[model samples]
Each structure stands twice: as structure tokens, then as C-alpha cells.
Target chain A: MNGCMERIYNGLIKENPTFVLMLGMCPTLAVTTSATNGVGMGLSTTVVLVLSNMLISMLRKVIPDSVRMPAFIVVVASFVTIVQFLLQGFVPSLYASLGIYIPLIVVNCIILGRAESYASKNPVLLSIFDGIGMGLGFTVGLTAIGLVREIIGSGKVFGFQLLPLADVAAGKSGYVPVTIFILAPGAFLVLAGLTALQNKVKNNAAKKGKKVREASGCGEGCASCGGCSGKVFPTGNEEE
Target chain B: MVLSENKFMMSSSPHIRSKTTSANIMQIVTAALLPAAAFGVYNFGLPALIMLISTTASAVLTELIYQKLMHKKVTINDFSAVVTGLLLGLNMPSSAPWWMGALGSVFGILVVKQLFGGLGQNIMNPALGARCFLLISFTGQMTTFIYDGVSGPTPLAVLKSGGTVDTMSMLIGKIPGTIGETSVFAIMLGAVILILTGVIDLRIPGTYLATFAVFVGIFGHFQNPDIGFFDPQYITAHLCGGGIMLGAWFMATDYVTSPITKRGQIVYGMLLGILTGLFRLFGGSAEGVSYAIIISNLLVPLIERVTLPKPFGKGGEK
Candidate 1:
């Protein structure tokens, strides 16, 4: 129970797939134009991550070490297809909105990264918790970015017009949408901004005598993000 | 080039260094820009004046506060922020709301300039970058120019159509346009000051204007029917209107963002002129000077790499 809980904590905060690990950047940047779309994409990715983790862990010993990569993908893709059909049958609107990204989740680095790094070595139970944790973290990140972009870009969130778009349309001098926040550049700017914010929080914690890792280089790309959020634990925790 | 034997041993190079600080350079640029700024104020009245003050204040204060909060050296004394603000101000329409000025200034100085690394490290001209940002973000405010309840089409807009313009009015800066770009004479006066002080490399402005002239002349017949190829009025109007004069002299010559070597400067200038011609002739907007300068600014690194001064003995030895 303790090890499983730690895996969940590790994925959500210590090694967040979106903000900290920066794993599935394609769908994280795309398909996050609105809150609803972000939630839909996130939940769909979550289903794939969890099922793929369990299958890979179950077949970890059975799969030959030589063809482990292909074996993991086969398992992940099967689960992704199941989620896709489920989404297509039920939430057709979400399926339509997140059109290409749903299939592309088969190649999402987060699923593969966890399979190679965590799930293949860990027990099925711990791997399942890790998937849940990383999925929730990714969901939080995507939804937050979508919330900001939608609120500023369209004055709406989850199809709710909190700022009343009719005022802008009628020229009644109300809140006008920034419009750029929903554009492509907005994704990059918001991503950088959110990443910077996370770094600031971690740095502040480090300053307060917390046992956090010091950020070394300029935190721009994936090379700098690997060891973020104080990856103090040693890898190869087969002892558990 | 000989160094005296008075505690000044002949260093390998850079014997005589000018004592002009970045602050000094910025102050010179600010002084040189005074005539054009005054012309903007004269042409557009209180609104233009308010814009200048507000923009400049915002840029300076933003830089000051940003540096202070970031625990870096406060560099607002270096009038680069002021120059950035003033350039953004000049680029704005006279009828632009007050907040636009502050927003643009802050965006230019803070985001474009300081964020990339203050002063010398910015890759793009901060003012031009901010101007483009404002143009894209707030299109209506950036394009709407009105004075005294009379809003007239800008000379560039008129020229974009097949209409003719008052050449003399454009030359003397008595036309309808952005706050400062309307007055060729005033801009020329400032350009002269910049040139005379040796603050500007005339190679850039000269090649830029010449290339612009040649390109516009070649493309004149296609863009306008009233003016034939190499037509005098067409050439004058193209050169005089649409921030070309302001951009060629001031923005393109920015020491930090522009190419450094003589050959590189000429290439940068010619490219800028060609881009301006292309945009004016075929682009969505009438004025292409801002976009052209920025595009050229981006190419400066590549230009410098290709056009570095040859080692002294390499060519001779070969």
C-alpha cells in the first residue's frame, strides 16, 4: 500500500507527465484549445495509460527482452483502440473534437516512457497507481491551460459564457476576447508560463530549506526537465 | 594609430576606445528623434502628445521595475527604453486609446527587450516587435487614425489603391498617417542629425533607400496605374509615405539588432528594401517597413556569420 501510494504521489507531483516530465507534448499542446476538449483528451489518454500499464506489467516476464518495445506498443495500442471505440460510441462530440489525437495516443511518449521506465519493472498494482497519478497530473495541466486560453481567448469555459460574449458582439463595450490565447502562439506562451511558474514554486521550496533539487540550466526543453521537482530518489527500486 | 608610451603599451587591438556608454548612445538617439516627435505632436495635437509621454513613461518604468524586481541592475537611465517607447508611440495612430500606449511600451521593453536579455541581447528591434504585437492584437486601434473629427485615408492606403497623393504634403510631413511617419522632412531632419553624429551607419540607410527606390520603380506599374515605372511622383510618394523614411534611418540602424560589418549592413539594408517593396505591392498591409526591418533583424546573425571580416593576412598570403 505504501509503495503504491508513493508511485501515485511520484507521478502526480514529483514526476508530472505534462509539467515536470514533459512527456506527451503533442496532445498537450494541441487538443487543449478548450477546457472540455482538454478534459476529454486527458480522460481518454488516462484510460490508455492505465490499461497499457497493467497489460505490460502482466506480460513483463513473458515478453522477450529483445522485442520489449514492440511488445509494449502492441499492448498500449490495443487499449487505445478500445478507448477510441468507446469514445466514438458514447461521446461523439469529444471524439470529433479530439479527432487525430485519440489515435496518436498510441505513440504518446508518456505511455511508452512509463512502460519502459516504471510499469515493466514494477508490479501491476503499483503500475496502475502510477498511471492514475500521471494521468491526473496531465489532466490538471491540460485543463488549467485550456481554462486560461478559453477564458481569455473566447470568454467561455466548458461552454459557459461567464463574461457574456454577447456584450462584445453588440459593441456594448464589455470584455473583449484576446483571441491570441486560443491561437497557436498562445499554447507555447502559456506552456512556458506554466512551466516557469512550477519552477518558481520548486525553487521557493528549495530556498525554504526543503530537500529539493536546485535547477541547473535554463529550463527551456526536455533536457532540463528530466531532473526537475527534486528527483532525489534513486532509481532501480526493486527492493520494494 | 600609434599609441603613446605613457603607461599605454600597444595592446594587440582596440587601442583607442570611444567613451560613449550605451546610455550616451541612447541619449543621442533620443535627441535625434526629437524633431520627428515634435512634428507628430504638431500634426496630431494633444492625443499624440499624451501618447508620447504615456508610452515613454511606461517603457522606462516597466524596465526600471522589472530590473528592480528581478534583482538586476536598473538600466532605465539608458534611454533605450525611452527610444523604444517613442518609436512605438510614433508607430501608433493618433486616435489610439491611452492604454494602448502603455501596453505597447511595456510589451516592447519588458517582453521583447528585457526578457530576451536587456539592451544588447534582443534579436529583434523591441519597438518594432511590440508594434507588430499591437498591430496583430488590437488591429482596429492600431489602424484608426483621426484628428479633429476628420479621419482621412493614409497616403499608403491611397497609394495601395490606384489613387494619387499630394507629393509635397508627404514630403513636408503634412499628410494623414501614423503620428510620426507622415513627415518626410522632419524624419529627414532627425536622420541628418543621426548621420552627422556618426551614430548611424549611412551605408544601411543609403543602400536601403536606393534598393527601395529601384524595387518600387520596377514594381510601380503593376501596383499603380496613375504612376508609370520610375515615375518621380510614384518614387517620392513610395519613399516619403508609410514609415519607410522613419524605419530606414532609425529602426534598421539599431546597433544591437542590425548586422555589424559594412558588407553585412548593405545586404541587410537591400533585403529590407526588397521586403518592403514586396509587402507594399502584394502584402495585406500598405506599410511594410516594420515587418521588413524585423525580418532583416532576424537575418543579422546569419549575415554576420557569412560576412565576417577576413583575417588580415589570409587573402594577402593566398
Candidate 2:
């Protein structure tokens, strides 16, 4: 049970396909222009990923090695087609917005990568967990990027105004939203800024881990070291 | 005196250094650019000179400011800023306001180059990126080209408007267009100098120009059946009318933004030519060279990875 839990945790955080591994960057950069579109696309992709993982695991042994990649692609494409049609029939707004990207998800490396790496080798239950964890990680990443872009780009969240504006009726000032954020170049700028932020976060985490290790006095490869040991030198010790 | 003589030592990664400094290379390139620049000034006059000065100054100023802000050692003395400024000026029309040129230089140096970690780290040509930004932002100002003291449509605009110029007029800069794009003869002369001086590789510009010529020849022939076969004039007019020469020789071959490998350079140049042709034929632009080069610049890294030079004894692995 603990081993299964570890696997699930690993997919969600340590081996996150989007932020940590930098997989599926094309869709992440393309469809993340708006929060609504981002969430819609993320959920749709998650559904496809989970279902495809489940199906692939069920047929893993029956499929041969020579034909495995083609078989996996066929399975993923079928699910993608079904999702594409369902979205078109029901959520036509999202369907229209996502347009070519829905078809593009068939080639998204994350889905195929999960199918080949985890689903084919693991049991059905473990594969399902892997799918759910990875899908949710991707969802979190896309939503975070979408939220930043949509808020700054449009000054609105999910198409609702959060900041009040004075309309300057007699002798007052008014609020006006900057419209540069909605353009294509703004997407590139925001993505670059966010990627830099992710790098900073990862670097900070590494520094903190090093500090924790030093406090425990495990200078070399000591096995029995505990959490706390000596006086903490916080600043210059970052070099060590 | 002979017994007391001392030796000077300099240690660096490159133990064997050449006399070819970055400044020397930049100066040589600028020298090679003189023919085209002089032709541009002759055709466009005082406005071209003003725009050139403003663009170059602004680029240098932006680099200095960015270096100060980023707390890095200042490198404005290297003449890269001058190159960027001159390239930006050449890309724009002479009629562009001084402020527009300044804004372009700011966008080029501060936003594109310094913010991306400066110089060699920049993913796209800073000048070309700024040009695209200005083109998208100030379409009215950017597209208006002047000729013979008459503010009129560019030759590409004439083509788009279903009009044509005599091939002889275009070859001599008589047609309305941006300064550097007025004479194909002058541009070819400058390109030859740069190639001979080893300032740029022949692969990119050579492939790009040849592919572009073929595209225009095949498509232009089909578009205008009234024009006779082997119409050298129409071909010359097409080559000189727009941003083709400037973009093909200077902008597309920007060292930092273009592919490194020879094969990658060929693919990159060919794709850029095809896209430029498509944009000119079907899209809402008379010339698509700037946008085509920028798009290809974005794909250079991917092309480089796919066309990586093979490692010895590592052939069989997928």
C-alpha cells in the first residue's frame, strides 16, 4: 500500500510531466491564452489520458513489442476522437476555442509517454493512479499559467470583473484595462516569465534541502544523521 | 638591459588566439554594408540619414542602460549595438519618425536581447524581432515607402494593387520602396563582399535567395501569363521591390538566431523562402520577409536538434 502511494506521489510532484519534466510544452504554450480555455483543455486532456492509460494497461500483455507503439497510438487516437466529438456536441464554445488543438492532443508526448512507460509495465490499478496523478499535475500547471495570463491580459477572471472602476461622471477618474495581454506576443512574454519563476522555485527548494542536510551534520555520506544538529549558518553556506 | 628583460603572460581558454576581434568583424561587416547604405541614402535622402542615426544611437543607449540595470559589465564598445542599430534602420522605411526608431531599438536591445541574457543567448535576431513588433504595432507608418521625393506605394504594394513597374526602373531605384530594397544590384554587390570577407556563411543567404527566386519564378509566371517567358526584368523587379535582399542577407543570417550546422542552415533558409512566398501570394502583405524570418528563427533550435552532426561510432542507435 505504501509502495502504491509512493508511485502516486511521484507522478504528481517529483516527476510532474509539465513543470518538472517539461513535457507537452506545445499545448501548454498554445491553448493557455485564457483561464476558461486552459481549464477546459486541461480537463479534456486529463480525461483522455486516464481512459487511454486504463485501456492500454488492460491490453498490455496481448499486444506484441513490434506493433506496440502503433497500437498505443491507435488507442489514444480513438479516445481523442471520441472526446473531440463529445466536446463539439456539448461544449461548443470550448470546442470552437480549442479547434485545431483538440486534434493536436493526439500527438501530445505526455499521453503516449505515459502509455509506453507506465501503463504497459504496471498493473491496471497502479496505471490508473499514475494517469490520475499525472493528469492532475498537468491540470495544476496549466491552470496556474492560465490564471496569471487571463488576469493580467484581460483584468477579468473566468469572464467576470473583479476590480471596480469609477466611470468619471462629474469630476473623477475611471479604470481602463490594458489590452496588450490578450495578444499573441503577450503569450510568449508570460510563458518566458513563468518559466523563469519555475526555475527560481526549483533553485530555492534545492538550497533549502541543502541547508536542512547541513543542520543535521551529515557532512559526507553518514547514514544515521538526524534532522537537527548544529548552529545554522544561513547566508554564505549556500556556496557549500 | 638584456639580462633584466621580462616576459608578459596572458592565460585564456583559447591558447591560440587570432587577431580577428569582434570589433574588427563588426567594422568589416559595416564596410561591406556601405554600398547598400549609400544607395539607400541616394534614393531616400535626408530622412534615411536621420532614421539611421537615431536608430543606431537608441540601440547603443538601450544596451548601456540594460547593462547598468542588470549589473553586468558594459559591452557597448564592442560595436554590436551599432550593427543592430544599422540593421534596424535598414529594415525600416526612411519616413518612420525618430521616436518609432527609438522604440524599435529599445525593444531590440532591452526586451529581446538583455532580458534573454544578452548577445549570444538571444534566441532571435533582436533587430528583426523589433522590426516585427513595430510592423505589427504601427502598420500604417511601417508600410509607407518613399521614392524620388514622392510619398507613394512601394513596388510590392504596386504589385498587390494590381499595378506593375518597368523592370528597368526597379533595377535603378526609380520605384517607390524602402531605402535598402531599391536596388538588387547594390545589395548583391554588398552580399558578395560580406561572403568574400568571411563575415557570413554562403549557405544561408545563397540557399534563401535561390529558393526565393525559384518560388517567385514559378508562381509569378503562373500569376501573370501575359508576361513573356524568361522576362529578366520582372525577375529583377521582384528581387528588388521589397525586404527580400535585406532580410535574406543580413536578418536571416544573424549568427545567434540562425541554425549552426550546414544542413540545418539549408533547411531553415528553404522553409523561410517558402513561407515568404506563401505570405506574399495568399496573405494580406506585399512582403512577408520579416515575419517569415522571425518564424523560421523560432524553429531554428528544433531544426538544429534534428539535424545534429553525427557522432563517430554512434551510428546504429535510434
Candidate 3:
């Protein structure tokens, strides 16, 4: 039981899918423009993640190594369709907001990464816990970023005006929000700021003689770090 | 006898320290900038002064607080913060509120400067980076330039609208625009001071102007639909109107951000000129000076690498 708990904790903190492993940054940057969209996207991804991990773990022995990737995609894509229809039926508003991103979650690196790294190698029950933990970690990261962007960018949080101003509610002019938080650049900036905050915490941990894994790169998404073989794809470069 | 004894003073050869410190150099640059900043305050009135002071104070405070929290030496005394603050303030419209100034200064110092490993190690010019940030964040607020009872578009805007601008008003700084950029005369006065002290060289600024002049002389007629190609006064008006003068002399020639070698500086300068021309003529916005310099600043490393000098006396000896 303790071992199972540790697996959960490991995914949540030790290799948080967003901040630590830096997986599934597409939805992490895109749907995180608003708090409600963040929670909705996160939950939908969580459902897909849990079910897919279980299916992948169950079929690990049956699936051949050469066709593992294709097999995994077929399972993931199947789960995504069900989730999409469910969202479209029950929560039409969220489906509308998420738009293409709801379907894009099938390709979220976090889902496939967990299936490949943990599920394919672990027991079915343990893989389920790993999926739950990683999904929650991604949720935490996305919600935090979304909340910040929403409040600063629009002076609202989760559709409620926490910092109420005349401009947002009425047509009158009053407090001007820092609109950058909601813009495209705001996503990159807020993510950078949060990563910087995370690094500061890690550095503090190191000072107390605690073991903390050093993080490298600016976390400006894969586009910036794609060519930086020293940081991102160390294994691929080494093999080459 | 003392001189002879001191000549053998236990140190390596070539032992003379110049009087120039970072603080002193920054001070000289600040002094050179005072005329333009003063003119901005005079022309734009009290709000410009408030914005200038707020930005300078915020920059110094951000540097001090960051260094303090990080357990490093505070370098606010070096006056680079003040220079960055002044330049960023000048880049902004005089109508900007105190918060924009404060935020811009803090962002420039903290994110652009300290996070990139402090003063000398940043990849881009901090002030220009902050200006771009503010421009992106507050497009509506940043673009509004109101003068007295009359609110009008900037000269660049006028040209973009297929209308002509009076060259004298722009040179004399009577136009409604960013606080420090309207006056060609004041910017030139500061540029002269920088040039004479050898703080800035003619290689970059000269090539920037020459290329810009040639480029604008050919294409600037399209900026004003009424004018035909190659009018001398129209070309001068194009040069005098925007932040090009301020950017070419002050921002592009930043010591840490610009290329080191002579040929590299020339290439860098011409690249800036061409990009400015392309953006000014073809881009959506009327002003392209800040964007052009910031983009050129990113290319300095490549320029330096290509212009690296060959090793000394290697060709003859080998």
C-alpha cells in the first residue's frame, strides 16, 4: 500500500507531468487562458489518462514491441472519442470552449508518456494510480496558470470578478487590467514566472541538504527547447 | 629613482588603469541623455516627469531587492538602472500612468537583466525588451499621444495615412508622440556627446543612418501616397519623425548587446536599417524602430562569431 502511495506521490511531485517532466504543453498553454477552461480540460484529460493506462497495462504482454506505439495510439484515440461525445452531450459549454483542444488531448505527451514509461512496465492497479497522480499534477499546474492569467488579464477568476471593476461589469472605465496575462505572450510569461518560482523552491531545498533534482532549460515550451539537445531530448541526441 | 623602482613593481607588463568605471561610464551616458529627457519633461509636462522618476526608482529598487534576496552585491549605484529607466520612459507616451513605468522598470531589471545573469550577460537590450513588453500588453494606452488641446496621429501615422507632416515641428519636438523621441535635435545633441567620448563609434550609427537614408529615400514615397519617389525633404522628414534617431544612436549601440568587431558592427547596423525599412514600409504599424533594434540585438552573437579575428602571427609562422 505504501509503495502504491509512493507511486502516486512520485507522479504528483517527483515527476509532475507539467513542471517536472514538461509533458503535454500544448493544452497546458492553450486551454489555460481561463480558469474554467483549465479545470474542464484537466478533468477530461484525467478521465482519458486513467482508462488508457489501464487498457495499456492489461495488453502489455499481448502487444509486440515493434507495434507498441501504434497499438497505444489506437487505445488512446478510442478513449478520446468517448470522452469527447460525453463532454459534448453533458457539458456543451466546455466542449465549445475547448474546441479542437478536446480532441488534441489524445496526443498529449503526458498520456502516451505515462503509458509507455509506467503502464507498459507496471501492474494495472499501480498504473492507474500513476495516471491519476499525473493527471492531478497537470490539473494543478493548468489551474494555477489559468487563475493567474484570468485575474490579471481580465480582473476575474473562474468567471467571478474577485477584483470587481467598472470596466469588466459595466461599460464604465475604472481599473485597467494587465491585459498581457490573457494574450498569447501571457501564457509564456506566466509559465516562466511559475517555473522560476519552482526553481527558487528547489534551490532552497538544496540549501537544507535535501536531495532535489536540478531542472535545466527556460521551460519556454518545446519550440524553444526542441533544438537544445543538451536539455530536452538527451537520449535521442546521444544515440545519434 | 622612485620612477625607476616603480617601473619594476612586481606586476605584469602594461600596468595602467584608466579612470573609467562602469559607474562613470553610465554617469556620462546619463549626462549626455539629460538634454533630451529635460526636453521631454518640458514638452510633455508633469506626467512625463512622474513617469520618468517612477521608472528610475522602480528599476533601482528592483535591482537592489533582487540582489538582496539572492545574497549578492546590490548594484543600484552603477546607474545602469537609471539609464534603462530613462530610455524606457522615453520610449513610452507621456500620458502613461505611474504603474506602467513601475512595471516596465521592474520587468526590465528583474526578468531581462537579473534572470539572464545580471548586467553584462543578457542577450538583448533590457530597455528595448521592456518597451516591447509594454507595447504588447497595452496597445491602446501606449499608442495614444495627446498634445495640449489638439489630439493628432504621430508623423508616422500621418505618412501611413497618405498625408504629409511638417518637418520643422518634428525636428523641434512639438509633435504629439513618445516623450523623448519627437526631437531630432535633442537626440542628436546626446549622440554627439556619446560619439565624442568614444563611448559610441561611427561604424554602427553611421552605417545605420546611411543605409536608412538610402532605403527610405527610395521607398518612403509609398508611405505618403501624395509624394513621388526621391523627394529630399520627404526623406529627411522620414528620418526625423520616428524613434529611429533615438534607437540608432542610443539603443542599438548598447555595449553589451551590440557586436564588438568593426565589420560585425557595420553588418549589424545595415541589417537593422534594412529591417526597419521593411517593417516601416510593409508592416502593419507605422513605427518600427524599437522592433528593428530589438531584433538586431538578437543577431549580435552570430555577427561576432563570423567576424572573429584570425590568431595573431599564425599565417607567416606556419
- Quick one: best DockQ, which candidate? 3
Candidate 2 residue A90 Cα shift, in angstroms, is 4.7
Q: Which lDDT value does model 3 have at B111?
A: 84
Candidate 3 has a TM-score of 0.88
For model 1, the superposed segments whose C-alpha errors exceed 4 Å read: A62-75, A164-171, A211-240, B1-15, B220-232, B315-318
lDDT of 2 at B58: 97
The better candidate by lDDT, 1 or 2, is 1
**Chain B TM-score by candidate, in order shown:** 0.94, 0.89, 0.93
Task: Give all candidates' CA lDDT scores.
Answer: 0.84, 0.77, 0.84
Tens digits of per-residue lDDT, candidate 3, B123-158, equal 888899888888887887788888875667999888
* Fnat of all models, as shown: 0.30, 0.00, 0.60
Q: Write the per-residue lDDT of candidate 1 for residues B174-241, one digit (tens) a residue.
A: 77778889888899888888888889968999999999999999898887666678987788889988
What DockQ does every candidate get?
Answer: 0.39, 0.07, 0.54
Q: Candidate 3: where is the Cα deviation over 4 Å?
A: A166-174, A202-240, B1-16, B221-226, B312-318
* Tens-digit lDDT string for candidate 1 (A51-122): 899889889889999999999989998999999999999999999999999999999998998899888887
Q: What is the TM-score of chain B in candidate 2?
A: 0.89
In candidate 2, stretches whose alpha carbon ends up further than 4 angstroms from where it belongs are: A1-13, A47-90, A100-133, A147-193, A208-240, B1-18, B28-58, B61-73, B94-125, B132-152, B160-162, B166-176, B179-219, B248-284, B291-318
Model 2: per-residue Cα lDDT over A1-240, one tens digit each: 233343456566666676777888888888887888888888888889999999998999999999999999999999999999999999999999888999888888889988888888766655676687778778777777777777766667876766554343464444333334456776666766776777777678788874212122233443332221122211111111
The residue pairs in collision within model 2 are: none
**CA shift of B162, model 1, Å:** 3.0
